[model samples]
Target chain A: MSVIVTPTTTGAAGAGDPTSTSPAPGAAPGAPAVRSRFTRGPGRWVVLVLVTVTALAVVAPFLLMLLNAFKSPSDYSTNGPLSLPTELYTQGLTTYWNQVNYPQKLLNSIVISGTVAVAATVISLLNAFALGIGRVKGRVWIIGLFLLANMLPQEALVYPLYFFAKQVGLYNTQLSVIIIFTVIQSAFGTYLLSSVLSTFPRSVLEAARLDGASRWQVLWRVIFPITRPTLSVLLIFFFIWTWNEFFIPLVMLISNSTQTVPVALATLQGDRLMDAPTTNAGALISLIPCVIFFLIFQRTLTRGVMAGAEK
Target chain B: MSTTTQTRRPHRTGTPRQSGQPRQPRPARRERSYWTYFLPGAVLFTAVIAIPLVYNIYLSLTRWSGIGTPKFVGLHQYTRLFSDELFWTSFRNSLAMIVAMVVVPTIIGLVLAAVLFDYLGRRFRGSVVSVLRATFYLPQILPVVVAGIVWGWILRPDGAVNAILDAVGLGSLAQDWLGDPSFALPTVMLVMVWVQIGYPVVIFMAALGRVDPELYEAAELDGAGWWARLRAITIPQIRPETYVVALTCTIAALKVFGPIFALTRGGPENTTNVPSYFAYTTFFKKLDVGYGAAIATVLTLIIVLVAAGFMVFQARAERKDA
Candidate 1:
């Protein structure tokens, strides 16, 4: 519920400095470690093999899930969860997919996550505009409040939120989740984005102001363009984080029609135990979009992960 | 980290140029209108965070069951908490979580990052090093619940791990990992270790990148072993990141819920129960919303105290380095 990790120092993440961002360690890595390539011949291979094995171990569960997702229940039972499927049996996939209306869950996830991303980024920009660029009085206390909000576990807030949603007729609606997550995710966005914006040059703002640019105009025309990259990073993160969320959605969206992917899968446990193959298939399906996102945004993600942690 | 904060600290309230007669009329008007920009966020924050926090804290002082009305229980819930054995177990599990999420991962991540950055990185093809780092970090990118579900599948009684054990004639060692009372918490801890390894690795590797390459070179030239170099240079160089990782992960460990929900739901006689999960069940399953709020209040207080302790420790550490 509270997995937001940031570089303790504010300016380090979005600062326009080459040395701060994490690069592929294999590609250039860093410099001046003279004769870094070890002269210890066979031992180096040992290290490489050992590291590769560890990596494989780290990813082994996903591999097992993938392999078994295509297996028929009979294959799993007969072969005892070890053998390759005699044939591609995707019935488990289709069965589980239809059973929980997987496509609906997928759509709900996409809609809720996407909406939260864009909306949270906008709110974060607005907040940062005041604190970072506008330099609002008592900004430190405000930023600290947002940070505390980010760190406060959802457990502390969930019951009241659930009660309120019911009172407002939002208990089972996607809009309820969106509203909650947009605010929560932006709590983090505000913290990180404000840190980046605090260093915004006075000269740039003054130049825009001298051009008769209104505060809104300067924000949209001047600051937004400059801060687009940071906003983009926040957008991607909010989408992924919201998609991965569990507890609130679990409590809020009880019906299958309203449940998101992970929540749907968890509800499967509540009713009756799913067969091995169906569970595997469901798990695999739930992770595919995330894996694809990882592949596509590898560089941005790699950069962003280090951005908040390195500084 | 200290340097950045220190430089920003002096011009706390307003800019240095505003020292005498303040700023120009245009600037002054602009500054005042900044409150408008803050209005939307302020409104949202109050509704979502501020209100709920105060409401939950108030609820902690009463007894409610999600119906009728909440009766004022005074400090009874707090007193009951002192005697609740389940409460103790939940906290004990949190300590174990800290071990799984922070202590072990940070140690392994430090070694792995060092080996990757210092040894395998320069010695081998870049592809191998990059591939390994990505693989280690792969789990970090997933919804932790998704990762937990997969591990649940693997560790089931007749699941992949047991099947592998049978295939290798080690079936005797196979057990129902999550179903067993004793093994449930440890199995969950082990799974958490897998889920957490990547975070520290990514942070530390990035921290290691900033280490002056000349320092490693100098140590090597002086005939220092890799272990010696790690102790003297690598650890000290990345101490700030270490502090960040420890602080963030400790709070995260204490707040852990998604994985417990997906994998065990604090089951098998509640051995794997955490305070977060306990609060959750008390609220929804057991219909003890007030007790849940009390539990939440306790957890939040502990997190606050722990975070404050870490900040003080970090400040002292920075002062020593200075």
Candidate 2:
């Protein structure tokens, strides 16, 4: 949570108007001394209430989904999706798990997302190292090209990719999904890493070189070790993004055995329309991994997103 | 090229032979080797995205069902798209979605972030702010399919929304939220707003950290209230972050697919059809590959142009800040 707290600490410490003739408390005394315009009055309560309501609205749908996931089919149908279950009714979940082959689909998602995350991080690391710190020619133009590719909508590419993959015999395979995700995700990965590396001290690399280390050795042994945090941020980003990716996998992985969790969840909805409890179970299944990953990497994801925006 | 090669041959061989002399490698030589590091990423990106994009442009000019050889039709699809009411409707819906996803969220997120940083910053510990921020961001991190499913159930006629409305004695206000064309688009946009608000809040909070609190304090001393302080200091200080939020959210709204697919499937007389969902149905469902490519090409161009505009604005803002 350092990523979340760092900004607040720095912001509170740096709090003070530079143009004021009177001395600000930010520069004086201890951490608690840095202060101005402390929250007071009825306005403070109003702000708290407003923020709390908004927060509830944001999470209301998920809460509804969770509540319905445990409801029996009859209860869900009779009471609608908002009511609490008399007891934990898991028959819908059991049916969904058995019908969809939950273990296989879950494995597919794990393998696909994991491979994409690892591969994207590795490829982007090399690309970022080269472009950010190396004396490569036309690096700015290359980075621009990557950014341009990054911005293009997926629709423009998915159809052609479908045809191309079919022609090349890579269709209906997890490899195709992995390759597509790694390439698409690596653009932002390269951008984030390159920005981080640009601010890194060059003297460290120089010192490594002066010790007679090869360039690859220095990159692997020195750069990789020092930049692990940034790399992990990219890794978690690729995992979350690829896990939720829908369109490409829908096009590429058509078979039930091959489809990822999102595709399976989507197709399951089509098959089980109006089956609220079953649909909720599948939705919960799809969301569980993302929520777990998010809880684990919440700070890194926030920092990574802010880093892109700051650039 | 032949003369350069001839001149460099002796230098290259001579350097290798003189390696025992503890001589430094030329900066130019060291720089040239860096391209090797870039080769893998560059080649993969080119193969996956760059080539397919170029191929997509070609496909847009042809009448292909994505199976056999494409018949060259020479911009027929584009001509048809220009006159297609559905395409225009989808485009308009995208603009509406942008209002919900980009415009409203940017405003709300900025206000919340400013309040958190200015008034609440001193009143509470940092963890409270973090917890509040996380709660807002929870929807953003959920899978779009999960979001779509939850919202679909909630927006059903007899679903959670209506149930809640009934409990509050506002039962008359409840309607078939997703099934009605007029209500569908707005409901989807509202969900988009809910999913998107946390992004700007987090970014703005980070940006706000860079603004010297003294500015807010100074404004307060001048009898500026909370809103005035936000208008004077918080907004200006976080301008670049604002552009970032706008750019990302606009692109997201334009390319949105899963939510529409799961929630409405561009239904209720296609009132909620955005370009991405429209393109998907045209290509995959209708098997009209050429038309899909055309729609996609147009969407890509719009995003590129919008992004270019945002970049220019960001650069100018940075220059001013500098």
Candidate 3:
């Protein structure tokens, strides 16, 4: 939510804004006066209605999924998809969960996303350290290279990676996807972190160095503490991104035990055993963690997005 | 090289020996050791990204089926790709994707961001604005496969959308959204629009933050309408971000795979086949490795060109703005 309100706060006009030409009633100094076009009566209602309708439309699919997921197959067939469920039917969830080995799939997703997030963040920190604070030669070129790597489609690299994983006997293992994503996710991380680090205050590093801090110590003790916020944002993003990854994991982690939640659910699409309610249940289960993450880190995720766009 | 090292050696040793004298270390010399920090990332990038990219290109020039020696066939796959009808259809469908993912979303998002910034933030409570934005953005947080699953069910013949359409007495409009050739691509496009709209809205809202509020005030003082002000000030002010959003979303549109995989699998006469899915199925399902690489290479080229074009436009726009 600060995502919406932040623009006003960060906008040019503020409480201390010295450019207050005409003060409005009970507003921060220099804030826009109430004379704007749509702020008046009737227009405000129109805008509110439009925005609310659009938001409801945006959420319509989720509502449909939720409604049907708990509806029994018999209820759905008799009354159609839009009707209310007769009871709290949970057989769909249990059937899909048991069929897909939900716990194992969740574990696979967690292990892969968790490992990739930490490993990628660490790798990116090091990479950014060299390119940003160290001001390494060809830093611009190197950062550009990382940016390009991030932009390249997974299709371009999937086959070769698949072939290599088979050759190296790492196919069908969660570790393969973990390692692959660590590099891929860190590409963006390095790009973002390098840009952030490039603008790091040189005086702080100089102070640390003068206090007898070695290069490694400066990285750990000085830079790490200062950049923890950005790093945490990157960590959450990496974890979620890795969890949501599909193509590579679909190709590499082909086994049931190794497949992540998304890959597992996706493979069951249109299967003989899957009912409408079962697919909905599976999808609902898969996105529960993501919804939870969104609720908890709404501010952080939005901040990261802003940071990325600005970068 | 020897002479240069010899000249620098005494300066380095002398600096270390003079550490007790409160002397500053040569920043350039200190930076040299940081090279070691980049080693692991470099190796990983080379193996994961660079090498695979180059190898994929190499494989595109050869004939292989994921087994045996890849026999080098000069320009064979490229020629085959040029003649492939499905390949042509896939690229053509990418246009639909661009409209859904880039063009429509950007327009709607710009206006929505303006509303949130210009009207809602000023009129409503902060919580209201936040809740509205979150509702718009909720789909973005879900995995694409989850989105795919949810939309797939909703758009099914017996699904909620059709059921609602029937109940509303618009039964004639109800059809098999994903299974039919005619409606599949457009339905998928609609889903893509939903999946993508929040991204630009969020980014543009942030862009709007950096905009000068006084512009709106100045325009209002001149009696400009809301749309007039948005047109004259907000769009021009955020052209840079518009470019960024367009480029990133276009690239994502071209590279779309998961939604297609989960929703339609490029079925109903392959009407919804985009390049990424085409390449994926060709590689894995059909076992046509070289052709898959060719498809991926073509898609990659198009994306790079689009990105370059967007950046050049952004640069010119920024220059004009400045």
Per-candidate fnat, comma-separated: 0.49, 0.54, 0.55
Report the lDDT tens digits of candidate 1 across residue range A188-244.
Answer: 888877877777776787788777788899999988977776677778778888998
Over B100-124, each residue of candidate 3 has an lDDT whose tens digit, in order, gives 9989999998889788766777666
Q: In TM-score terms, which candidate is top?
A: 1
Measured with C-alpha atoms, the lDDT of residue B298 in candidate 1 is 95
Q: List, for all models, the DockQ compared with the true complex.
A: 0.44, 0.40, 0.42
lDDT of 1 at B227: 96
Instruction: Report how far off residue A258 is in candidate 3 (Å).
Output: 0.8
Tens digit of per-residue lDDT, candidate 1, span B1-322: 3233544654454366434323544643544488899898899899888998899988999999988889998988999988999999999999999999999999999999888877776566555666787788788878888778778888899899898998899989999999999899999999999998987776777667667777977898898988999999999988988887899889989999999988898989999999999999999989988899999999999988898899899989888978
Q: What is the lDDT of candidate 2?
A: 0.78
Q: Which residue runs does candidate 3 get wrong by more than 4 Å?
A: A1-40, A299-311, B1-23, B26-32
Q: All models: lDDT?
A: 0.82, 0.78, 0.81
Candidate 3: the clashing residue pairs are none
Ranking by TM-score: 1, 3, 2
In model 2, what is the error at residue B204, expressed in angstroms? 0.7
Whose DockQ is higher: candidate 2's or candidate 3's?
A: 3
